[model samples]
Target: MKPIVAIGDVHGLEKWRSIVDEHEDCTIVFLGDYLDPYEYITRRQQLDNLRDIIELKKRRMDDVVLLLGNHDLHYFCDRALPGSRYDFQIERFAEAMFNANIELFQYAYQQGNRIFTHAGIQHSWFVDDFKGDLTQPIAHQLNNPESIQFNAMLRLGHARGGRIGKIGGIFWADISELTDPLHGYTQIVGHNRVDDITERCGYNDNKIIFCDCLRNGKYYYEE
Candidate 1:
């Protein structure tokens, strides 16, 4: 099997360039958040970085998988989500770029029992909210959520500042919201920031691996 290398939230960093170049032979999954950089990174730099990523995907379609994160969604979607650090200054440009190449992005990716998403999936959110099918690959359901399912995917749980009882969707789930990983699957996600690549095991030996450590100069890799 080809090796898999998962990159975490970009936040306008250029480190991804080096990582991708180093893993040219591997299947690279970008965990999104390509925009909304820290104050240090200029908006132009952020925009250019995003363009570079899109171009890379265009050049290496077979080897790259881009999963949209909450940050990326605010720019792509019509409705605005409640969150800080949204780059309104460049929204028009970013939105256009995303729409133009939307086909290159998806909500999730899967391989065997491993599923990759921007954020972790909670049990209740999957069973009650998402209403996903266990028999089908998660990516298929998520990438093609129906109107209602699509709205569900935009939910933000309490941890992320949503209503008291709501559970966040795949794109917005916080690490704290995931009390249990989805049954019979290992979820790889990158929305919540962490000090390092972290792993939590749940029922049936299912697991959720948090990889949003790009800010700390870390990434996850496996064969």
Candidate 2:
């Protein structure tokens, strides 16, 4: 993989499919949220999308990294669910995916020096939890990926029956409140909806880039 393409929330799978062809010389890091079908999408269709992605991961384990978002974590932990979602159904579908690709659905992926996750890391939590560091701590946690800790940092959030604004976990962060408290690498994330991919300077040499425009139909191709 030459250049890495970090994708935003997969409300369904259109965004994911749209960027597949762009993977010729690049690794694809899919930020999760694979369930909760959009208004026009059906549950079966959503599962099919997920199934295809899971299969892709199986085929190209090294080339594809599937990081969990709040929704994915909801099914993984089966608690603190953000209202009544398809937790049970998604769990059933994800069981096969997770079992076959256990190491794939980690909390975050660090490509080069940049960190990619479903939601951006909370500025404060990165300091508190990870001891004011980004890449190393995230990589270490992903090594184990246990349920309790992953849930606290990943799934506990706004629409998922948790508080709206706080320095939560990687998957639970609200990007708007994120600050760059670390140095070195940039953090690329999904979850928060934006019109286009935007980059902002952080406290140190770090950057925070938002990659959630697919929800609004604003793609990299559009630019």
**Candidate 2 on 52-152: residue-level lDDT in tens?**
88888888788788887777756646453452356565667665665666666777777566778777765556656544435455655654555655555
Which tens-of-lDDT digit does each residue in 24-60 have in candidate 1?
8899999988988764899889999999999999999
Candidate 1 lDDT (Cα, whole model)?
A: 0.89
Q: Which residue runs does candidate 1 get wrong by more than 4 Å? A: 80-82
Q: After superposition, how far is residue 111 of candidate 1 from its true place, in Å?
A: 0.5
**How many clashes in each structure?**
0, 2
lDDT score, candidate 1, position 193: 82
Worst 10 residues of 2 by lDDT: 214-223
* Count of clashing pairs, candidate 2: 2
| Residue 148 lDDT, candidate 1, scale 0-100 | 91
Question: Candidate 2: which stretches are off by over 4 Å?
Answer: 83-91, 130-137, 142-152, 155-165, 216-223
Pairs clashing within candidate 1:
none
